[model samples]
Target: MSETSSSVLTRMGAAFGSMPPALWRLLLVLAVFLVGGIAGWIGRGVLAGPADVPTMSVYEDWHLLCPALKTKDGACEISQDVYEQRAGERLARIILAKEKDKSMVMYVTVPLQVLLEPGIGLKLGNDQVRVYQYKTCTEEGCLAVIPVDDQLLASLTKAQDAGIDVAQPNGKAAELPFSMKGYADAYGAFLNNEAKRKSWWRRLWS
Candidate 1:
């Protein structure tokens, strides 16, 4: 392997070696549960009728998902899932969607073992960290719905990485990091799709 690749592997090995065994087990379980939930979600969409089937497109690490047949409230979004490298388990899922008022919203879902009091911390690149409270928790996981204003959106577009921080039930802090490598491209495409959808709807009504 190249020297750079070897160096990266060394660092990753060291990091994983330092992680606690209990944490690893917890992450593995969480990953399995989350994946199953996602599968069920997709299955339901598939069974919802041919007109309501879901479609997904990939842009680097980000995915743009939308319904086959658009409805008045059917808005598309870009999402990414962060995984534990060692066990190949999902650590968290992040989604960005646009609202009717032209505002953006970020939905972060993490394992249910997180402490809800501290909420969830979002750090984009080197900027200040923002905390969003847990809006709800279901069988899948806990979700934090954060409103993304113009400033936040700008940061996201230019950011190279994002870190999501949450506290475990035992009060230990855990961070789920994901690359922003394709965020700009994915979001741009998402905007274009939204515009086209809106235009189509307008024409239909007119």
Candidate 2:
């Protein structure tokens, strides 16, 4: 047979034009299947890939409440100035919270890779608190519960940020920043709550 050649599109169009209706339908169906298979493969590859890490926030769960925000009817209006971030897959968190006795406590939870002997160091402005002993450690991480006195509390409230310092076994140091966004307000609220609880207990017993 003599060879007959043309441009790719023209040759394809001619072949398709000369093809029987049934054969043309079969080719169309095969083309659709091929395209669909390629699309599905791409989708699966995208879905199975590693997910993107999220951006972490500095102030995570910092809130303040004070009696000054209370109304005249003996009901204190609570402010919802909350700043909190989810640790999720992240390593460490420095938490400042209040106890039942109105005392402030600082707790640091770090990854299991950290050394627990020297304790966790904390610094607020010019003041520094030495390594608070490690309380416990688990698969998640280690915990250091530091005692915060009135003087330290005052410094923390006035300072913009605090630092959690850790000394590695190799004598190197790692520092993490703790945001002081809503410290004063939260401390005020904690004191008010403690006072209210004490007043109620005294009235019940007396």
Candidate 3:
């Protein structure tokens, strides 16, 4: 390997070495569902869309994404793309969506080269850290779906910064940071759009 590549790998090994065994075990258990691919199914359900072109609206750093052909049950989400600084390559995409039951979910998609055993880490604001297992892998990348409870939702709305951490196959750790500059406004618009759609559907059925 080139000197630069070798140097990067060395740093990764050192980082992983410093991690406690118990932490590794905890991450492993959290990621156990990866074997069954249940999260993959859920990812598909949440992200899949018809062939029609999608529409996008920007709210500062976040985007309001919706399907082109609108129906009563059309899907929409707030999203942002993270990029690698040096190479300017797209690193990951973060998505936030609300379920029919009003629960929130966040999907983090990273490169296919990610290490699945350790799953991934989510950092919100200063001290909160959440570890999530990989739900599935596709040609695009691997995905981790995080269920957002009320507390987590509040954190996201209030956090000024957020990041996703992943381990590389070579044992290197990478943190992909995404901005929360307009998350609250984007999410509010998402909720309003969802409510309008649901109300229209109910009126039709009624």
Top lDDT hit: 1
Give the alpha-carbon lDDT of every model.
Answer: 0.87, 0.62, 0.84
Per-residue CA lDDT of model 3 for 112-135, tens digit only, reads 998999999999998567899999
Superposed by TM-score, candidate 1 places the C-alpha of residue 153 at a distance from the truth, in angstroms, of 0.3
- Candidate 1: where is the Cα deviation over 4 Å? 1-54, 68-70, 100-102, 200-206
Per-residue lDDT tens digits of candidate 2, residues 100-175?
A: 5645677677777777777788778777656688899888578887778877767877987666777676768787
lDDT of 2 at 1: 32
Better model by lDDT: candidate 1 vs candidate 3: 1
Sorting all predicted structures by TM-score, with the top scorer first, yields 1, 3, 2
Give the per-residue Cα lDDT of candidate 2 at 64.
35
Q: lDDT per residue, candidate 1, 1-206, as tens digits?
A: 99999999999999999999999999999999999999988986776544445778899999999854456677888999999999998889999987777678998999998999999999999999998899999988999999988899899988988899999989998888898988898988888777767686544533
Task: Give lDDT: candidate 2, residue 21.
Answer: 96
User: Which of 2 and 3 is the better model by TM-score?
Assistant: 3
Q: Candidate 3: where are CA atoms >4 Å away?
A: 1-55, 67-70, 100-102, 200-206
Candidate 2 scores a C-alpha RMSD against the true structure in Å of 20.8
